[model samples]
Target chain A: MATRTQAAPTTWPHLGLGARRALWAYAFLLVPLAFFLAIRLAPAASSLYISLHEWNIISPEKPFVGLRNFQTLLADPRFARAALNTVRYVAVGIPAQIVLGLLLAMALRRVTRLRGLFRALYFMPFVTPVVAAAWVWQWMYSEQFGPLNSILVALGLPTLQFLRSPGQALYAITAMIVWQYLGFQIVIFLAGLEAIPRVYYEAAEVDGASGWQLFRHVTIPLLNPTLVFSIVYSTIIYLQLFTQVLNMTFQDQGGPLASTLTLVLYVYQLGFQRFRMGEAAAATAVLFAVILAITLLQMKILSKPVEY
Target chain B: MKHVLALLAAVGLLLGLASVGATQQQVTITYWQYFFESKVRLIDQLIPQFQAQNPGIRVVHENFPYDTYNQKVASAVPAGQGPDVINLFYGWVPLYVDSGYLQPLPTDAFPVQELEREFVPMLRNSRFDGKYWALPTAVRSLAMFYNDDLLARAGVARAPVTWDEFLVAAEKTTVRDAAGRIQVEGFGIAPGGQDHHLIREVLFRQWGAAPYSPDGRRVTYATPQGAEALRWYTDLITRHKVGAIDFFPGANGYRNAFMAGRAAMIFDGSFAIGAIRGGTRAKWGVAPLPRRSAGGEASNFGSYWVHGLTVRATGPKRDAAIRFLKFLVSPEVQRVWLERVGELPASRSLVSDARLANDAVFGPFIQGLAYSRATFFVDETAQRQVLMDAVNEVVVNNKSPMQALQEAAAKEQKILDDFWTKRAKKQ
Candidate 1:
C-alpha cells in the first residue's frame, strides 16, 4: 500500500509517426479553427436563435415567439419590395456586369501595347474605396447639376432624370455598382482568357471556323468556369448591396418610394434604425437561405464539364 | 536635532497618505455625445469647471460620429458598459425609453416642478410614462435662411411674408440657362432633407390639421387638408419649377446649397446658424417661415438634444452623473453653451434674456418658440422617411398627392401600431 514509484518519464506513445505528424499539423490549425468557431459560426448560430425571439438589445427580457418574425416578414410589404428589388439587381446587374467584363477582356487580350497600363487603368475603380466611388457616382447622377446632364444638355438632348426619379434610381445605382465591380470581373475573365490554349483557336481556324464561330464554339465553352465564378460572385455582392445605395441615396438612405432597397439594406434599417433586432435577424436568415439556394443552383447549372 | 528631523518626516508621510486616500475616494464618470465641434469645445471647457465645483467627482467626455452614435449606445448600454451619462437626440428618447436604456431622473434630485420652471415649454418632450427621463441644455426651431446676395441679385427687396409673395420672390430669383437647365435654384425642395420636417409638421399644422392625432397614437395626414398641403409643397417643384427634386444633391442638401449660394432660400434650424456663419462667404439672413396666408396661424418645428442618464449607472456613479447633469443645465453653463455653440438656451429665463431676444439672427428663432411644436414620434427617422417617400412619389413617380399621402398614412399607422403593441406587451 504506499509504494510510490515515480512514473516512468512520461512520453507520447501509441501514436505512429504519421499520426504524430498529423497531430502536430492539427495543433497548428487549432488556432484558426478556434477563431472561426468563436467569431463566425457562433454569431451565425446566435442570429438564428435570435430570429426566433423578440429582442430589443437593452431590454432585460427576450421572449421567444417561434416563427412569428418570419410570419411577419411574409406579410411585410417592405420585405416583399426589398426581395423583388434584390432579384432585380441580380437579374439585371449580374448579366450586364458579366457581359461587359467579357467584352472588355476579349478586346484587351488582342492588344499588346501598354496592355499592363490599360489593365491597371481598368482595375483602378476596383481598388478605389467604395464610398469615394459612390460619391463620385452620386455627383455624376445628380439630375440638375450633374456632368451627365450637362453633357446631354450640351448635345441638345433632353436631360434624363437619373437618381432623382424612382423609376430611374434603381437602374442608376445598379449601373454604378456594375461599373464599380466591372474591373474586378474583367481581371478574372482576362486571366481565364489568357489560360485558354491558343492551339484550340488555331485548330478552329484550321477547321474553317470564322471569328464569330470560333468565339462561340471554342472560347465561350472554355470560359465557362470563369463565367460561373463571376456570376456567383456578382450575385452574392448584388444581393448584399449596401454601400453604393447608401452613399448615392444618402438623403433618404433607401428612398424614392423604397426603389433602391436591397435585402441587406433592409436588414440594417431594421436592426440599427428601428432597433427591431428580431425582425432583422429573421430577415438575415432569409437572406442566408436565398444566398445558399442561388449559389447551389448556379453551381448546378453553370459548372457542367467542358471537354476538349 | 535627529529626533526633530524624524518627527518632520513622520508628519510629511502622514500628509502624503491622507492625500492618496482623498484621491482614492473620488469617483470618475464617463459622458458620451455625438460630435459637434463647438459643442464639444464648450463641453471640454465645462468639464474642468464641473470637476472644480464637485471635487470628489471627475468627468471623462467622449464623442462619436453622429450617424453611429445611436447604434453604439444601443449595443453598449445593454452590456452594462456604456457611459454613465449620454447626450441623445430628442427624437430618440421614445425608442430609448422603450428599450429601458435610460433611467428616470430621481425626483428627489431633479423635481418636475423645477424642470418646468427652468426649461422652456418644449421640455414636455422629455417627459414620458409620468416621469422625466432627460434634460436639455439647448433647443432649436426651424426658420428661413436666405442668401442675401442671391436675393439682392434677383432684386427681391426683403424676405417674403406670405406664400404668394414667396412664390413670386422665388420665381424672380431663379436663374435658368438658355437650355432651360437651372443655373441657380431660387428655392430648395429637399424632400429627404429639411423639407421633410416642413411638410410633415409646419405645413400640416399650418393647414389647420395636426400631422398626427392628439394622443400621437395614429397617423392623421391622409385627410384632404394634408393632401392639399402636400400638393402645394410639391407644386414648388412640379408647377412653379423654382426648385427641382434634386436641386441640391447628396446629404445636407438644402443647407449646403444655401451655403454655396446655389439656392436663394432654405428652411433650416437654429443649429445651422453657426455653420452658415463660418462656412459661407455669402451674407445670410434668418427670417420666420412664411405662413399659408398673411394672417394665418404661424407654426414652426422644434427639436433638441437631451442628456440622459443610462439605467446601468448605479450607486455613487449614478449620483455623480446626476450631479453632472444638474451642473450641465445650470444657467451659467447654459449661457456658455449659447455663446459658443449658437444654440438657443433651453432655460426660459435665459431664452428670454434681452441680449439674445434682440439679436437679429437669434430673434426670429426665439420668436418662433411661441408657435413652435415639437413632434411626438416613436421613431422619428422612420416616420420622416415615410413622409419623404410621399413627397418623392408625387414629385418623382408622378403619383397623385392623395394617393401618396394615403399610402404614407397607412405605413405610418402600421409603425405606430407596432410601437404601441410592443409597448403594451412589455407592460
Candidate 2:
C-alpha cells in the first residue's frame, strides 16, 4: 500500500501520433470556422464599413460621408423616442418576465403526476412561432370585436383602447412580450430547482427551520446560478426586441405617437424604410455594445463562485 | 469489384435519365399576389385561359394578406426564391425601384405609348422618378359614403355640399349621452387613419394649394393656403366638435361605422364599397366630398394607385413576362378583374362603356376619377416620414398647423440640402 501511494503514474511517451491526430482534428474544424466567419463575422464587419458611407443598396453611386449619418441620427427626434422606449422595455419588461417565470416554476415543481404534460402546456407559447402568436394577440387586443375588450364590456367596465392609447400602447406591447418569453425562463428555473440536492431540505426540516426560513437560506442561495442565467439571457433578448412592435401597430407611425417604437425597430426603419443604411449600422453597433455591457453587468452582480 | 462497378454504372444511367426528364418538364411560373379568397378563385378560373394563351408554361399561384405581402416579397426576393410575377402597390414602387429589384418594362413589348391613350390622365398616376414603374390595374377615388337612414333620422334631407354645410349637418346629426360624451357621431373622421384624405389632401385641393410645387422639387405645404387648409381640418375636432381624436379606435373600420349607423357619414374610397355591404343592412348613398367653404369651386377627388406588371432588367424570361403582362391588361381581363374586385378600370374607353357608366356605384367612381389627383411619390424617405409625422401632429395631437408645417418643411429642406451637398462631392 505504501509503495502504491509513492509510485508515480506511468506517462505515455509514445502517444505523439495521437497528439498529432488531435492537431489534425483541430484543423478539420476550419470548415465550420469558415462558415461562422462568413455568416456572422463577415456581415458584421461589412455593416460597420457600410455605416460610414451613404449607401441606398441599389444606387449606382455611393457618396462616402464620414460621421454624417451618426450626426443626423443624433438630431432625429424619432431616434430619441425609440431609444427611450427601448430602455423602458428592457427595464420593466425583463424583470417582470423573470419574476413571473420563477413563480410559475415553483408551482409546477409541486405537481407529481403528468408533470411533463403540465410543463409542455406552459412551454407552448415559447415554442409557438412569433408571427402566429403576434397575430393572435392582435386579434385579442382588437378595439372593436376582440375577446379581451368584449369581456371587459360584458363586465360593465370601460373598454380600454389597448393599442390605440399613447399612454397604454407601450405597456400593452410589453405585456405580450413578457407573456411570450416567461415560459422560457420558467423552464430554466425548473431545471435549476430539480438539480438542488434534497438532503439539504431534509436537514433544514429536521433542524426545525420554517418554510420561509428554509427558502431564504437554502433555496435562494442555491438558485443564484439559474437567476443569473435568466437575467443575462433575458437582457440580451429584450435589448434586441424588434418584430413584436412592427407587426402589431398601425399607421406605420409606431402608434398613438411613437410610443411603442424600440431601438431595433428604429434601426430597421432607418435602414429599410429611410434607406439610411449607414445610420442603421451605427445604431446596430450601439445596440450590440449596450447588450454586451448589460450582460456583463448582470454576470458581475448575480454570479457567485462555486465553493468546493 | 466488377459487380460493384456494374451497379454504379446502372445507378448513373438512371440518375441521368431522371435529370433529363426534369429538364423537359413544364416551367412552373410562381405568381405571388395579394387578393382575397374570391379573387383567388376567379384567378384560378382564369389560369386555364393564360395557360392556353401560352403553351408549356404552367402558372402556380401563392397568395397572402395585403398587409404582409410586401414584407414576404422583401424577404423572399433576397433569397432568390421570390415569385416570377408579383402584384405591388403603387406607393411601394419607389422602394422596389430604388432597391434595383424591379425590371423596367420594355418599350417594344408593352408599347407604353399605345397603352397610354387607352388610359385616363389619372391612370398615369403610376409614373415615378420620370419612369412608369407600375401600370394602374384600376383606379378609385375618395368619396362621401353616407347612411341614408341616419341622415333621415337627423332631419338632413341631402348630403352636405360645402364645408360650412357639412359642419352644420354633422352638428345636427351628432347624438350624445347624458354625460355629453359622443355616442353617434355625424361624421366619422379618424385623425389617425383617414386624416390624410379627410383633412389634408381634400383641403389642399380646396385651398388651391398644389400638394407639391410645380417643379416637384419641394413641399409647398408651408404656404399660406396650405396653412389655412391644415387649420381648417384641425379646427373640426377642436372647435367644431364634429370629429373624434381617437375616431373608432381599435379594430373599428370607418366605413363600417357609417354602415352600422354608428356614424351618419364617412369619407372613404371605392375599395371600401364591398366591405360596407357586409357591415350593415342600412340603405346607403354615395356622394361627392363636401367642398372647402361653400361653393368655392369645389375640388373633390382623391386617388390611390394600384400595382402594374413590369419585366425584369436582367432575366431570361423578360419577354415572356411582358407577354403575360399584355395579356393580363387586355380589356376583357380588365373588365373581369374590376367587376369581381371593385377595381376601377384604368382604360379610358372601358370606363365610359354603358355597363360601367350606368352602374350606380361606378357612376360616381368613374366621375370622380376625372376630378382625381394622384399623390406625389417623393423619393426622399426623410421628407416622406416628416410629412406623415407632421400630418399626425397637426390632426391628432392638435398641434398648431403652421408650426407643424414649418417644422416639416425645415426638416424636408435639410434632407434636400444634404442630398445636394453630398452629390456635389461625388461630381
For each prediction, how big is the interface RMSD? 2.2, 6.1
Put down candidate 1 lDDT per residue, A1-308, tens digits, no spaces. Answer: 13222221235545655776799999999999999999999999999999999986546567999999999899988899999999999999998999899999999988899999999998988999999999888888876778999999889899888877768989999998888888999899999998999999999999999999999999999999999988888888999999988988888876677888888989998887777889899999999999999999999999999986
lDDT of each: 0.86, 0.71
Q: Pick by TM-score: which candidate is best?
A: 1
Docking verdict class for candidate 1: medium
Q: Against the hidden true structure, what lDDT does model 2 obtain?
A: 0.71
TM-score of 1: 0.93
lDDT of 2 by residue, B331-416 (tens): 78778878787878877788878777777766766766666766644343455466656656775566788888888778776666
* Residue lDDT tens for model 2, A1-308: 56533442334334454675686787998889999999999999988787778776435445678888778778878888988898888889988998888888999999889999988988888998886787678767765546887777778778776776667888888999998998788899999998889998999999999989988888878988988888888887877788788766644446656788888988877777666678898788778778888888889878976552
Superposed model 1: Cα runs more than 4 Å off? A1-17, B1-28, B60-62, B65-68, B74-79, B313-319
Pairs of colliding residues, candidate 1: none
